[model samples]
Target chain A: MSDDKLERTERALDFSGIQAPEELLRMKRATPARIGIGHVGARYKTAAALRFGADHAAANDAAFSEVPEDIPARLGFFSVQTLCRDKAEMITRPDLGRYFDEEQKARILSSCRYAPDVQIYCGDGLCAPSIAANIPDLYPAIRDELVFRGISVGTPFFVRYCRVNTARVIGPLLNAEVVCVLIGERPGLLTSESMSAYIAYRPHPDMQENAYTVVSNISRFGTPPVEAAAYIASLIGEILEKKKSGLSLKQNEE
Target chain B: MKDVLMSAGIDIGTTTTQVIFSRLTIAEKGGFGAAPGYAVTRRDVFYRGRVHFTPLLPDDSIDKEEVARILSEEFESAGLRPDDMDTGAVIITGETLKRANAKEVAESIAALSGRFVVTTAGPHLESVLAGKGSGAAELSTRTGKLVANVDIGGGTSNLCFFDDGAVLDTACLDLGGRGIRIENHKIAQIFPGTKRILEAESIRLSVGDSADLPSVRERIENLADVMARLLAEALLLLPESPTLRKVVTNRLITCDRIPEIVTLSGGVADLLGNLPEDPFRYGDIGAFLGASIARNGAIRERLNRNTKETLRATVIGAGNESLTLSGGTVFYQEIAFPLRDLPVVTLPMDGANPEAYGEAIGRAWERIREDGETTAAFASEGLSAPTYEEICRLADAAAKAARQKDPSGSQTWVFVFATDMGKAFGQAFRRRMPPKTSILAMDSVRCGDEDRIDCGDPIGRGDVIPVVVKTLLFDNGERETI
Candidate 1:
């Protein structure tokens, strides 16, 4: 093909996806799933392929990026680090991400109140962008709900290179009756900016995996952060009342 | 996987009254813990009552006792009771709404039928419902073409245009099958509107006139010709005829494009098919009107003969097409579970400054207030792809607006959202606004500029609510479409 002709073909290959019927259009609008996108033979259309590539790149970037330094100060929370020394270590050694370093543990012990009603910790898990995007709205909503309900809250803080299980370590250390860690979820091809909350009441080192109650998918496209915060605050009140989390709480609710 | 609601529809028209029983199935399509929502996945009409001449009293008022008796008998034959109904509508249509006791009769039937049955009347709404019932709305969606449903009943012809399953515009005319009533093959009475038209056409017709005369047939043809001309004017967007304009009721054709297809519905529509060939059928000129429409060359060329319904459209639409299921993720206080007939005001939010959102909402609320609608629901097409910060901003603005309107925070603030962000925004608004302000915020309820909504108690484990949207703002001065 001639160069000009090739350029034209490439430009024309910019298929604008599918033309769905009105009924299907309503269904498609209500969801974020990749549906009704017509294919070019066996492959996805060029536009859809390009979009997938872009979303994948975003997910990888979110997984590797560090939380910005000023985020903690902006949110009025102090920062600490897990035993995982750096990003590479955090990715390779999952076990190390669940514990705090000795020095950081002492700092936490000094700064946080003992056996408070609720202890909140922000963690940059697999995706830092999720934390960066959601925390400002989520933090205040959670605080206001808990405060209005007359629940005592300990000093809030942030953790770097943290895993969800870090709540198992921090909860017992601060003698917290209930601990909630809002951590970044593993990035997906569709969304990298999603967060999840892990709540445990009186968590112990040997607590089973099912001991924690989790509310996941907090993002712009998911259960939005502000709403999730309200739900979490109410869940905490239930946890404190029933003195249970996870399976027990679920059973109690049923 | 699906929940079924048994619904009933009672349509009281000028000459005939009928009942319909339908089954609406709501299906949950949301994936586990994902964007949860429910929709009316299927609707089926199971029972259709035999059409009967409407019972009227000496004063031309509806016979309430006789109407209730007919409904009870129909319910018993259908093997259903009033308590079996989940939600439905009782519509008083056409000239029947002009009856002395029309509202009272409709209200009585609604009370006797079910807990959530809605009663409404008006030319515009009747037009829209008939169009939906006649399947013009669904046809528009299937064919991707504009369709107009013209319901020619006893005392009115209601015209409603639909595009892609949504009502576009509606018009009504005081032309129907019973414009002139015939008794024992003689003219018993002529409606004043029909008399004026006959005088203008130079046709001598009066009460007690011989119905067997050729000029009487010509008068009937004249009424049919008027109907045809008015329809042409409405469909072609032509200027109204000076003589015909007097009979034009409600809004006129405002849609930019002409309808590609037309469907005829109502009792007069029964004449389009084989209807026992009785000229004095039901003691009205309905048969002649239907014959005139079928033979009118202007209308014949445009009519789509294969309609989904004829006389049953209004009843079917009222029974099955009226109720919509709200989105699953919504916020509602227990105290405000079943709010009815709250007018909806759509706030302009597109390309608007974030700071001015409160002022825009305040202005919209004030407009509704001027209409003496004290408690109203504020509706908006929420921010698209809103980020957490954007949500907070919108919520803050909404909180400010609510507080400014009700400083004491003792009243309940209702908001309807066309986007999936209702729960999020409701939570933020609750947290920011004064503690005393009760919030009833819901999503996925689409409202037009002139629409009002009735919200029923939450259903499906409190996951969604039943909402009925009534379009009533057509008479309000022109406004931009949202």
Candidate 2:
């Protein structure tokens, strides 16, 4: 990121003596891939190889970084952690990442509003940096839209070292009509700030994966965070009206 | 869910008339409910009618009844009724659009053929269509090269430049094949433009001139060579000749740069396929003109050896390439199908400044009212992934400005947005509009100044509007830069 000129140059096909320079430049505008790097003696150029290495390191940092508890507290949401202690266990022991003790459960019910029309929260699923990058704009877009529609939403919070399955426990425990989880997606070469939203209607302990409706690949570079928020808002309205989500919702659409 | 729509293209040109029907597949992307952003994913031309000479009465007016009969017969042969078609275009091109009854005749014919739309008639639009139909656009898109095509029809030669499949600039000239007609080797009829050119060249041959005079034949060949040189100059293959300005019709081409490939189309190009021995075989100067153009080294050097189409480029373009789909989530409560020729007014968006945005909307509304339009499409290049507050602010400003002008909400309001924020803005505008107001908001569509929007019936799995942005006539006085 430090070399601004190199960042723009590597993404474009700027090889010398191109017959159709304008057309090749147009193709460059359409994609984010590393292209147009002319090789010397059948090997990668030094700058291009270095840029690839730099991008790989950034993805790793996004995966291993932790979102501080103070960040969620500033947004007026209480935070809790799962059974996993660190990033190693969160990645290796995904089964442990889905659990919470009785003491933490007591703290959740006490701090959260009960039986609201909809409940939404965030989790550091795989990329913690994505949470701070998108939530400030994303959260209000969804909340204000639902408010305008005269739909009620419950208390929001954060869960550390979380998995997608955690929404199942929160759904039945709070007795909410619908539950939505905004979490970070696994980092890819193109972007480390992408996030996802998983939603369901009336969750239970034994619910399957197909029970949740999901929208993913959300970031400033992918689907705009605010645009994704607007879509999630309307989706919540449809789920409440139809009383369904995931496979059932798709079937009903047919 | 996948839906297929049947479409027909009817071209009423200066020298010939034709009809073509195509099946357009509308695939629901993302999912069925997600088809608000929809397009014709695939197009297959199922029926192509044989070319027929355009029938003209003694008074030089198009024979309306004969035209109608040709259309009916073509549809019957294709096993399709007019009602079977979901969307299509009827384009009256070249000199035919200048006839007194052109608009009325075109409208009636369009109505006779399903929910068809007629273009107002513009050379730029025609140039783009011909470029597309002739495969020049596709060639540039596929090979990543700059391509240009000259559609040499009966009364006009349209030059369009394509860079990576998008139109860059267009120009038209009063050059064509049917300038002089022949019968039994004798001159039968001469159009006014050809008469003027002949008089300037000092060639005294008139109608009913001797069929086998060597002097007259030599003069005609000289005229053909002169025209071929002009065509070469138009593509910058040669130096700009002295007569270049006099032959240009509406506007001059501003491509400025040389294209990698150039293609020829229309009837003259069709005639060049095998270099007919008889110059007057088709009762016109087309064959002789084609031969002369083929001999011109400047054009031959850059010509595309593979011509995808010759005589049917514009007609195929009209039929298959005219339909565009509206995208993003949309909101339209009670709009009727096939809304044709809604004049567009583009409102200026002052980026995050609500007060400036409101003033801009108010001024644009006044312009629409001044133009005496009962309904118009308001277009904007919308913000990227707009936040909720930004959407609300803009929507609120627009609603308030509109309320002051048309308090009773008698005029229908249609917002043509440029991004997927259509439904979001639609919902916000819906909440604040007057109770009697009806609105339509659609996005992922682009339109230019002076263009008209024609929205066909909602089709397929999603509420996707088959939209047509028709630019019939335009004067690019100050040419646009890339």
Measured by DockQ, the strongest candidate is 2
Please write out the lDDT profile of model 1 over residues A39-103, one tens digit for every residue. 87899887767766777798899999999999888889999999888999999999999998789
DockQ of prediction 2:
0.35
TM-score of 2: 0.92
Q: What DockQ does every candidate get? A: 0.20, 0.35
Tens-digit lDDT track of model 2 for B150-238: 99988888999988889988888877898788899899988766766666656676899854688888777788877888888888778
TM-score per candidate, chains pooled = 0.81, 0.92
Report the interface RMSD that candidate 1 achieves against the true structure, in angstroms. 4.4
Give the per-residue lDDT digits (tens) of candidate 1, residues B307-408: 899899999989888898877767766346667777777886642466677787778777877877777888888764455566677777877887888887
Superposed by TM-score, candidate 1 places the C-alpha of residue B45 at a distance from the truth, in angstroms, of 3.5
What Cα-based lDDT does every candidate model obtain? Answer: 0.79, 0.80
Q: Candidate 2 — which pairs collide? A: B37-B327, B121-B472, B122-B472
- The predictions' CA RMSDs to the true structure, in order, are 5.9, 3.6
Cα error of candidate 1 at position B109, Å: 3.2
- In model 1, what are the clashing residue pairs, if there are any? none
